[model samples]
Structures are given as structure tokens and as C-alpha cells.
Target: MKLNLTTGIIPSLNVSAGLLGFFFVKTWTKFLEKTGWLKQPFTRQENTVIQTCVVASSGIAFSGGFGSYLFGMSSVVANQETNFTDALNVKNPQPAWMIGFLFVVSFIGLFSVVPLRKIMIIDFRLTYPSGTATAHLINSFHTPEGAKVAKKQVKTLGKFFSFSFLWGFFQWFFTAGNNCGFTAFPTFGLQAFNKSFYFDFSATFVGVGMICPHIINVSVLVGSILSWGIMWPLIGNKAGVWYSASLPSSSLSGLQGYKVFISIAMILGDGLYNFVKVLSRTIISLSQEIRIKRKDVLPVADQNLPASPLPSYDDERRTKLFLKDQIPIWFALGGYVTIAILAIIIVPLFFPPLKWYYILVIYIVAPVLAFCNAYGCGLTDWSLASTYGTLAIFTIGAWAGASNGGVLAGLAACGVMMNIVSTASDLSQDFKTGYLTLASPRSMFVSQVIGTAMGCLISPCVFWIFYKAFPDLGLPGSQYPAPYATVFRSMAMLGVEGFSSLPSHCLQFCYGFFFASILINAIRDSVGKKWAQYFPLPMAMAIPFYIGSYFGIDMCVGSLILFVWQKLNRAKADAFGPAVASGLICGDGIWTLPSSVLALAKVNPPICMKFLDSATNARVDAFLLGS
Candidate 1:
């Protein structure tokens, strides 16, 4: 059973909701400040309820959106069929209560912040300040004059976001209007590919995935070296052995079985590795907890060698020792460990759960993975790490055993989930930072959640809508098989059937994992110190080349723009760049939703097709004749 919905609908609703919420919160915060009900952070106090709400909301929203993106990207890149998208339609294409159910769940999730805040930050001191954006927003409220200036800046950002939303919408409209369009002069189309040349490091996707220039340069070269430089030529001579004599009749029906298998293996392997890592660390950390007092996972005291001889396990000690010389590493380590455990136990029980270990693993291991992910990728935003952690737990829990295949399916789920969650967590941290320093938590929370939920719901709906919108030509259908979904289908293939055999493609990911691990480690070591210690090439490989390229492009452009702005007018850039980025993100929600809806509605195929043809034709004309 498959749910038939358009991707655009979710985004449209999210954007609309986010705008309203953001505006409402902003207005309320201002009114509260003016009436002396609340004093701003920069003005005096260290914290306030309103400020906390703003920052926390940012964290939640960012986590939700980025989390969904990571899961969707995993499915998209792996070309998998199963994911959050498919989950909605599992056994019920048009579930009578899905939208209503989701709305209820989301609404319940909202109140979670107020109570959770007291426990997480006030009691546990978790430093869940991944809401760096919110922190920044709070920072803006220092003085009356500064507040006015910041408010004006927010308005400006809001307008810029509007423009971005319009641009994204127009772009989507044009692209969706046709499957592929050719420009006579440039000979390019939105969906064009190079079949003759299998290796293209220069593709827009590779850049967009945030493949650092250096890594992209190396990875593509290596993959090409394997596939093109060596394997393709070998296959040319042994084509009969490698492929069937006759090509398959249906492109849609001809699933890329091997690709799906590899994707599952990657997910499983990563997930397992992370699960082990997190469980071990938390078990050791929680030696004090009554549940684990009988067993000993921690290192025996005094029996161990000096900390300097081996790797130092003490986080604070490592930090202080590296930076100043005052605080002992144990001080930071103890607090960090306590908070990690508390967060682990608390989160999944959004309503209390019977099993504490599950929540502990989700909370503790998830965030560490997120932190590692951000540092590994050079994203360097804590918010991203936190959000990534949250997503990792959810995705892995939901899909690990069901979707990932081959040996150690559970392990694979843990590993893949950890990495994905970590990345999402880091992004959330960035969002929080954006709001904390400038905006109120209430505003940030509402907008962020709306955006995230929108992304999550729309991605799957969009694909389905596209399939319906454009009836398969039966030549080469646009409805590519969902990669992860295929992996889930392959779980049965691992059975004891005589024909069953280990998936050959699964080895590629292991190869990728080992190869990337070694390569990144080497790069870090070459830099002398551990400054480059956390690179996550293995995780990057789990993602597809296109998404990786997109991330790379996104990071490069963003970092470069920030660098330039900082150099030219540090004050203005610092004051307003975040707002600009926020606006851009919000705008994406606005434009993407409606356009995707149009694509999904199955309104009129021939008419829509004609519109697409005209749009493409016009573009070609412009390119060729010079518009």
C-alpha cells in the first residue's frame, strides 16, 4: 500500500505555520520586554524562560527538519524504496487518520519543551545549547538601542527570506514543468546525465553535498579509478559474465538490486558500530546507576597506566589541559557524562518508557555521533551535532532491522542511525545559535518544527506526486525504485535458499568504510595535531555523490560568503547574516510546498506537459539566441 500525496503540500503548510508562529513569538517577546515582565539576556540576566524557549525551539525545529533530510537523503542517495516517506503509506496508501494523527503527535511534541527544559538544562545542565541561533538572538537584546537595531535587522531578514521563497518556487515550477529540457547553445537539461562518461567530479550534486574540495578531488578520483579506470574496462571484455544477454524490458520494474544491497550494508554496518560505541561508553559512564552497579564496564582505577601514556578519556581534562591550566579533566568529564546519561534516559520517553537502556543509548550515543559527524565534516556547528543525534536514534530505531540487510542488520542500523542523527544534531545546533542571540525561543521553536515536519512529510509525497504527474513512458520511467525500500525487500534474499548468496555489492560499502577511514585518518595525522581528527569520510560515502556534491557546494558558498562579508563589514555581516540565512531557509518552505502540490495533484497531464514543454523551450531559446 502506498500513500499518494504531493511533497509540496507539507512544505506549504509548514512555511505558512512557521511564518505565523515566528511573527507571533517575536511580537510577544517584544511586548513582554517593553512591559518589564521580562528583562533581555544581553541587558542583564544569564537566562530567562522566554529566552530558553526561543533557543530550545530553534534546536527542536532544526533537529526535526535536518533529521528528516538526513533520512530522506539516505533513501534518495541509496536509491532505496523504504524510508520515512514509505512509512506513511505502509499498508494504507490513504490512511484515513494520518494527517490528523501527525498533527496530534506534533502538537503534543510542542509542550515537551517547557517541562523538558527544566529537567534537561536546569537540573541536568545538559548544555543542549545546540540552539546557537537562538543564543545569538538572545544576545541581540542587550540594550534598548541594540534591540531596535536587531528588530529592524530581523525585518530585513524576513523580506530577504520572502525573496528567496519566491525564487525557489519559480525555480521549482520551471523544473517540475518538464522532466528534462535542452538549451540549444549549452545543450543542458535539469535531469541530464553523462552516460558515456561515468565519472564526473564536476557535477553540481557532488559540490552540493559539501564534499570538501580536497575530499571530492580525491574520492571521485578513487571511485573512478576503481569503476572506470579498472572495472569498466575489465567488464567490457567479460560483459557476457557480468550482465544478462538481453536488457530488461521495464526500467521501472528493473530494480538496481545490487545498489540497494550495498545501501543496506552501509546502513547496518554504520549503525552497529555506533551502537557498540555508545552503549559501551554509557555503560561505563553509568557505573554509579543502581541498574548497573553490579557490573563493571569502566576501567579499573589505579590498575590503569598514566592518562598521558594512552588516550585521555577525561573530556574536561583534555580541554583544560589543552587550553588553560586550571580545571581538572575529571570535572568536565563527570558533568558531561552525567548530562549525557540524563538526556539519554529522558528524550525517547517523551512520555516515560519501560526500558531505560533504549532511551539511554538513543540520548548518549546519538549526540556523540552527532558531534563527531559535524567535526568530521568540518561543519563545526554544535547545533548540527545535537540534531543529527536526535535523527539518528529515530531513523535507526524505525528502519534498522526492517530495511538494512545482510549480517549484523541491527549493528548496521545503529551505525547508520548514529551518523545521520549526528549530522542532523549539528545542524540543529546552528539553528539554535541563530535564534538564541536574536529571536525569542517561542518563535524559533514553532518555525523550526513546522519547517522540519514539512520537509519530512513532503519528500516522499513529492516523489509519488511526480510519478503520477508524469505517466511512465515505459521507455525509461522517471519513477526510479526507492533505494532503501529495495534494501528492505532484500532482507529475505539472505535466506537459506540454495540460490541465495552474499550480496556482492555489500562489500563495496565495507571497502568504502575501511578505505575512507584510513584516508581521513591519514589526512588528519598529516596535519601534525588532532585539529583535523574528526573527519567523517565513511559517513560521506554512505550518502550519494549528488547529495555530497550539493552539501559541498552549500558549505563552500556559505563559508566563502561569510568570510567575504566579515572581511568587508564585520559589524553588519555579524548583525544580519544569520537572519538572511534563516529567511532563505523559511523561503524554501514557502515556495517548495505549493509547487510540489501542483506536481502531485495529477491535475491535467497533457496541459501540464505542454506547460513544461513551453518553459523548457523558452529556456532553450534564451540560451541559444541570448535573452
Candidate 2:
């Protein structure tokens, strides 16, 4: 209870409890079905467990997932400032407007999306595939004798839970440090050989194989080649003198300015490229839809025009209901409009006299971006959607009060939001498959959403705690020299600078152009089978080279293992993947939830002393063995 309250784990705890409680409800439902208690045609819908799980999961997942990315972006923003300083120092761990927005919006989204289940699931058949997976597990116990089998499965899951708990603790205490990097100990100069390095001797590879698509996995590899193999070495060596002066003595002294510059350039470039592609695609798509509708209307007109006995096209079909086609657009538009209206009102509240044009621009670009995201998710090109959205926001910002901090912050917020939407859409796609396989849509939806929310709430708090705990990293406060804040502050400094193009705006536009060229080319090529997928490739390039490299290798290894296992024993390997994924998720809880607890407890255990000692011993042992 103490840990639960302190860590904000209560909500998630409630979620888990709720899930378990629903199991009993499911059991009863099954019993009712077996006994013909409810004589409905459809499988006597078991709502309690699945719906509860979906709502809980979506909220948690969106929150946590959004939080993690928010932290990542904020870190980048903060580091932007730290990079320029001779000896950087970050301020108090203040939450940004974006963070607050995410917190409030995520909860609302959680609730909002629930009402959508009926629309998305029952009416439109949106295929809640994850629910199908859960249902399979539940229905496995159904028979003439009631839910005796389900109770046994629950017991089995409980056993797994116990092991999962122990595993989480061990990793938390022994290996994980700062929840930042992988591995437990340093192996050599500026390098470490930990879980960060190995995929636990192929276990991670197997897991990676299950999740990562072939295109993305390949893109990641390509990105690693560009970033780590080409760019990092080339840029670092070419500008060695600047690096020598600017960088700290320790490689990890802190995030260096040069590194930040390069990263900013890459993401900016990639995002711009994606935006143009998306905009063009959206325009074309909307045009086509309009054309199709027009075609129908015009044909009807042609027939009705003259007092002709025969129709013009000879097909006697009138347009029925294109209702299905409208559903996706409506949902996408509704989400965008709501967020845009809120943003418009909120921004004005913070700084009054907001132009209606500002709101209109946001509303316009937002749904276009959302459509791109939803469509991209369908194609499994998450990279394309995110970059496109980022670019769209950047372009819109440039048109709007481009120089303002609010605009830049809004840009960042939009970037983060678009990324989550892409992820959610991707999950939705996965659930589509799961649903086809008879998986439980409700359960899957709940699980994922809950995971996202948990991520959001926990990430900010964890960020704050870590920022406070390690002041040396120049964390906690605005790291980017508060660039957005500076942008805002400059408003007062320059009386004439209102609503005009700033120097930063020029840079943003230039970068956007450069990106647009590359993105357009890539999209053009990717249309046919002769070309390599370029959007995700650039995205893969944009992420940290090391992380991308690891992911690539992990995916490759996992793919290999899956191939071998499936060839030898199909059913076992299939089951194994889910089990491992579940384990990792359960295992992750060890560190994720506990940090919040420890911070709240105020257990000032000298983490540095303990970390250094353990790391040192591990290194010495490795060295001795090597010698």
C-alpha cells in the first residue's frame, strides 16, 4: 500500500485488480453460457473483464508512452541549452506545458476512446485483435463442466507472475542504472558490456523477431549504417578540433553540443522530408475521395439532365451508404478538432489576443497529419507517419507565429502527439490481425492503453526524481537554453518582432525544404516494388545509431531463432514469443515502478557509491578473465 500510494501505482494496481476481478465475471459468464442462462445468439457477451481492461489499459499505455517520448523530447530540448555552456547547469525539474497537456489529454483520451469501442468494434468491425487473443485464453476453459479450466489457467498465470516479480527485482537492483542505459558494468574505456550489449544471448533477438516488421528491421539496419558507420565517425573526425575543445574529458561527461546539433539536424531533416510526402499524399487522397463522390453525383445528373429514357452510363445503381469510408475520417477529424480547439483556447489563455487564423491553421494541419498517421499505421510504416506529422507542424508553425515559444512548444507537442497516434494505430492494426485469429479485442485495447497511460504518468515523475537525484547531468530543468522560452522572452525584447519570420524560422524552413526533397523522392520510389522503403529508413537514421544498431541486431537474431524453432517445433516457438514478451513486460515493472517508490520514501541510499563499486568489481573480473 505504501509503495502503491507513493509510486502512483495505485491506478495501475487497480487496473490489475480490475482485470483479475473481471476474470471471475468471465468465469460466471462462461457458466451462464454453458447452462444456457442467457439465450442470446451472440456468445453471451462478456463485457465486465474485457471492457474494463481495455479502458484501463488504453489510459495507462497512452499516459506512459506519451510520458516517455515527452521526456525524450524535453531531454533533447534541455540538452540543447546545456550543449552551448562551458559548464552547463540545469535548473529545477519543472514540468513543461506539453507534459501537463499530455497528462490531461491522455486521461480524456482514455475515456473518449472507450465510447468509441462500440463504434469501432461492433458497428464498423475495426477488429480489436488483442481482445481476440485474450478471449482465446479465456474460452480455452469453456466446456460442459463450467470454468474449471479457466481457474487453472489463472493459477498458472499467477505462478508466472511470481517469477516475473523476482526477475524484475534482480534486474532493478543488480543491472539497471539510472533507467537510461542497458548493462550493469563497464567493460573498457567509455564502453560497457551489459544487457545493453547482449540480447541475453539471443533471447532479445527472438523477442525482436516477433514484433519488428521486416521493413522496419531493415530500415533500422540501414540507419545504423548511416548514423554509426558513416555520419558519427565522419562528422566527429572532420570536426575533431571543435569536438576536442567542446566535449568534456569523459565521453559521458554530458551530452555534447556537436552531438546535439547533428541529432537536431537529422530529425529536422527527416521530419521535413516526411511532411511533404504526407501532404502530397493527403491532398491526392482527399482529391480522389472527392472525385469518386463527384463521379457518382455527375452520373446521376447526366441521367437526370435530358428527358432521356436511358441512363448515361447504363449502370442502374444508385450510391447507397459510403458510411464505412466516412467512419475513419470522422474519428480522425473528431480527435483533431477537439485537440485543436483546446490548444487554441489554452494558448490564448496563456497569451491573450490569439488570432483565429492560428487556430484554423492548427485544425487544418492536425487532421491531415492524423489521416497520414492512420493510413501509415495501416501500411506498417510508422516512421513515415511520425516524420510527416513533425514536418506538418513545423511548416504550420513557420506560417503561424513561427518565432514564438508557444508555436515551437506546440510543434514539439504535436510531434509527440502524432508519434503516439501512429503507435496507437499500429497497435490497432495488430489487434486487427489478433481479432481475425479470434483474440479478445477489448482485452488487448485495455492492455495497450493502460500501458501507455502508465508510461505517461511514470515517465514525468521518474524524470523529475532522476533529475533531482543526478544534478551533475544538467537535467531537471529546460536543457535547451530554454530556447522556446527564449523565443517567448525575445517577444518583449523586440517590439517589432511580432508575427514575423525569425532567423530560427528561416532555418526551420530551409531544413524542411531539404527534408521535403528527400522524402518526396523516397515516396516516389517506394510506390513500386523496384525501390527500397525510404521513409522509415531515414527515421531509422534519425534515432541514435547505437540504439538503432542494437535493435537491428536484436531483430535479426530473433528472426533467426524464430525461423529455426518454427522449422523444428512450430507450436512451441509461437507460444514462446508471447511468453517472453509477457515476461519482459512483467520484468520491467521491477525498475519502472520502484524508482517512484524509492524517491517518495526518501531513501537516500548513496546510489553512486553502490553503482561504482559494483561496476568496478564487474570490470575487474572481466579483465582478469580476459588476461
Candidate 3:
């Protein structure tokens, strides 16, 4: 109870309500099937679209989960300086206005990617794993040919959900907490070797590994090995800190440490090159797309975009429904323009505006970053927008200079950059989900609007509850780590001041890696994309540079599971692997709710730390639970 529900915010973030809700929604949709109130035996396409919409809308409605919708965009900055309480003597709804301001700014990126449906979904088949899994989960339940498969999925879903929920409940109540419930298998101690050896039993991550391209798995694994296993010790010894700090700390203490900052400098350098690379590719390709103006496709003069080819969807109405978009580009652009003006002029005046160029840079840099964010999302199942956000804050903050007012302005722009990248990357992935499930782009747009509206109205209230509860959200020993925000906070501070905080070794590593990334990318692009695919991704390499190698290991394990399954039973794995994986993910996500509620109410498990030795821990966990 102390570990899991100590602060009362939800414990598990990966648990999504979409798959769990699918069962109930599916049941409800079927019960009304005969009355023409629903699609009889709800088609996979319809169910997936509706479910996606619901998930997207509800999440965007509030800070429901990490990285989903109510992006802790503010969470990082909250620790820096909270707009949580109104400023002194300001009896204005400044917080409310800022929330609304951010809400409007977010739409700029969300809508920006609509033009790229052709590039992201139609041409390059990025295995957006969750999107693919959700599509499969929806299909498994509804297809007439797969009735048995669907029923089996339902049974497996229930089993997985029950087991995951009960285990998580017991784990939180009984054993340990913090990503540390029997899941991490963390007995090995803090050696780099131990870090390399650990595994994370997250089915959602494994599911992600399952659906994305095998190259991704390989690259991530290679990155983990090359960085964590090989690079750290060299960097540490070079800094002459090996005698004192044998390994990277893996916490904020790690921030000032030589290993982590060296890693950051390297990551930042490579990341900048990769950022430029992707953006250029996106621009060149997008321009080509626009110039050609493919004769088969027309610009959305009549509020419709062409549908991705969905051979499974034979219904004509599906095409009609999917093609129709309610908002026109002109209208959306006009609204965005109005909001940009308000954000730049009116809202900032309340806090006092920065220089004109500061606002101009926020407007300029944000949309440009949005382009490649889609490309990055397509390749890795991640947005890579956070990288953009961190760098943007750093660069823009450095330029804006560090007077009290300038620091505030730079931080404000950091918030904008955060929203811009997050909004673009997040919506792009969700949009891919719609495309895969053959949902209307327009309908998904509306769904996003619903989420955006809900987030605007509700997130502030939800955030206030958490902030009021734990004023120390990002401080030491606080329930909310606001881990990403720590990075943002650091960058904001440094950007305002300069790169003076980075040590000598850190600067050398940064310069070295930055150029190395540039040279590598230039060579790879010269060799053409097919050849480039073999290299470990720069972004993947960056992961283990600061964080531990466990994420790469987990993804590798997940992907390898799929690889082995493919080797053994390719057909069965292709047809049903995703369904099984989705069941695992849904199970974990759904059960987190009850466990969280239990903690919120101050319930404790029967057994706890000192009371349980290895003997008791082992038996009390599996045997007492009868599993």
C-alpha cells in the first residue's frame, strides 16, 4: 500500500481501457444488434474505430496515463515553476487561459499530419504495433470466419486480465512496488552486467516488440549492447570516476555523474543529426508528394481524404464514412492562426511577453519538428518528439538568454515545444491506428477534437488534485517521479544559463558523438535506405546511453518470441499472435484500476517487507494466491 498507492495516483500506466472496454462495448453493441441500433455482430472495422476514438478521446480528456493523452507536458515544468496556483495578486484565470491556450496550440500539430496519411499509412507499412494489435484484437472478436478464434481470445483475455490484475494486486499489496513488483526480476544487484542481464515482464512492451518490424528489435538490442555493455565503463574511466562511482546511478544523482552526462552529450549530438535527417526526408518526400499531386488523389476540396486500401472491408458505406472529414483545412488553419495570435500576444501579456523573436521561434520551430516526428513514429513505435522537445528547449532557451524574464519566456516556449512535439507524435500514432482499422480520418479527427476538448476542460482539475496531494511531484522520494520533467527542468535551467554545467568530458563526448552521427547518417543516406536499415538506429543507441539496458532487452525478448513463433508456426502466429499479446496488455492495464482504488482507500496487503524472507516471499506470493 505504501509503495503502490502511497500518493493515490494510479500505479500502472500501461493499462489501457480500450481492449478491456472492447469486451463490454462489443457485448452492448451486439445486444442491440437486431434493433438496427448497432452493427450486427459489430464488424472489426467499426469496433476498432469506435474503440480507438473512445480511448483517444477519453485519454486526451485527462492525464489518464503516461504518454497516452493528457501528456504530463506540464508535469516536468510543474517542478520548475507551477502555474498550479495563480500568481500573487493575479485574481485572473491565468491557469485556465494557459490550459486553453495549450489546448489550441496542440491542434496545430495534430492536424498538420493529416496530409501525411499517404506517406505514413499508405506507402510505408510501419508496423505500429499497438495500432496493429488493437486492429487484430477488434478483428478476433468480430470476424465470422474467426468466431472460434474470437471466443478463444475472449477467454484468454479474461484469464490474462484476471491473472495480471490479481498478481499486480498481490504484488502491490504483498511484495514490493515501484516498477518492481515481481515484474523486474531484480535480484542481480547494480553491476552493469546485472543491468544487462535483467528482464522486464511487461506484455505491452513485449506486444510492441511483437508487432513492429524485426529490424527495430535487432537495432534496439544492438544499441543496448553497444552502449550499456561497452560504452559506459570506457566513459567512466576516461572521466577518472570509476574508482568512486563504479557504475551509472540510474537516477537524478546520475545527472551530474560523468557516465550519464557523457551519454547525454553523445545522445544529444547523434539525436540532432538524426533529427535533421528525418526532417529533411519528410520534407523532400512531402514536397515530392505535393508537387506530383497524384492524379488519383485530389486535395480535400469536399472534406474527404482517400481511404487506405482495406481488402477486408468490403462494405461500401465504410468507404463513404471513412472518407468524410468535418473540418476543412482552410477553417482549421484559420482557427490555428487565431489561437497562435492569442498565445503569442494575449496570453503572454498576462505573464508579460518575451521578445517578438521568442514567440516567432516557438511558432517556427514547432511545426518544422512536427514533420519528422511522424517519420520517427513510423520507424520506431515511439514519437521521438521528446528528443525534439528536449533539444528545442535547450537551443531556444540558450538563444533567449537568462534574465528572470528571459528564463520564464524560454520555459514557456519549452512548454509550447513540448505540446507541439507531443501533439504531433501522439496524434500521428493514433491516426495510424485509425488508418489500420480503416476508420475515417475525419471521424478520428472528431475523436481527437473530443479528446482535446475534454483535456482542456478536465486536465487542469485532475492535475490540481495530484499537485495538491503531493506538492513534491518531482522532488526526492515523491510518489510522482515526473522523470521526463527532470530532464526538461535540467535543460530549461542550462539553456537559460548556457552549456557551462556540462563537464569537460561531457563536452568532448558531445562533440565527438555529434559529428559521428552526422558522418554516419551521411554515409547511410548515400548507401540508400535498404542498406541503411541494417545499422542500429541512433535513437535506439541513445536509450541505453542514460537509462539502463533493460528496455532494449525486454523489446528484444518480445521480438524474439515472435521470431521463434514465426519460425515454428508462421501462419498461426500471423493470425493470432497479436490477439494473445493484446490480451496480456489489456489484462495488465484493466486490473491496475482496482489495485489503485484499493491503495487510494488506504488498504494494505496482509504481508509486507520485514515479515517475508525468501521462503515466505516465494510461497506467500504464488501458493497463497493459489497460482
lDDT of 1: 0.36
Off by over 4 Å in 3: 1-23, 34-49, 58-104, 110-143, 146-151, 176-197, 200-255, 286-326, 345-357, 364-384, 405-408, 421-442, 455-482, 517-534, 590-627
Q: Of 2 and 3, which scores higher on lDDT?
A: 3
Cα lDDT of model 2 by residue, 110-185, tens digit: 3233323333333333323343444344334344332464354345445555665565454444322342223323
Q: What is the lDDT of residue 152 in candidate 1?
A: 66
Estimate, for each residue in 362-475, the C-alpha lDDT of model 3 and write its tens digit.
776666667567666666555555566566566655665554344445445555666666666666666666665666677667767676666665655544444444444444
lDDT (10s digit) by residue, model 1, range 1-627: 011111100111112222233445667767998999977522312233333333333332323322222222232322222222232112222222222222222222232232222222222223333343344344445556755876666686578677766665444433433332210111222222221122221112221222133343334334333433344345345433544324342211122333333434444445445444444533443333433333334566445534424434543342333233222345435644564455344432322221345444554454345334433322222222322432433444343333332112222233234333432333334333422333333443444445445533553344344334434311112322222332332332232121223323334544565445555545764776455634443333443321112223333454456567779999987676555555655565455456546656744223222213467788988899984
Candidate 1 to truth, TM = 0.50
* Regions of model 1 farther than 4 Å from truth: 1-24, 28-92, 95-124, 142-146, 176-178, 181-192, 195-240, 243-258, 263-536, 545-556, 566-575, 600-627
Q: For candidate 2, what is the lDDT?
A: 0.41
Those runs of model 2 whose alpha carbons end farther than 4 Å from true positions after fitting are: 1-100, 103-165, 175-182, 185-209, 218-222, 229-231, 238-244, 249-343, 347-357, 375-385, 396-536, 546-560, 599-627
TM-score leader: 3
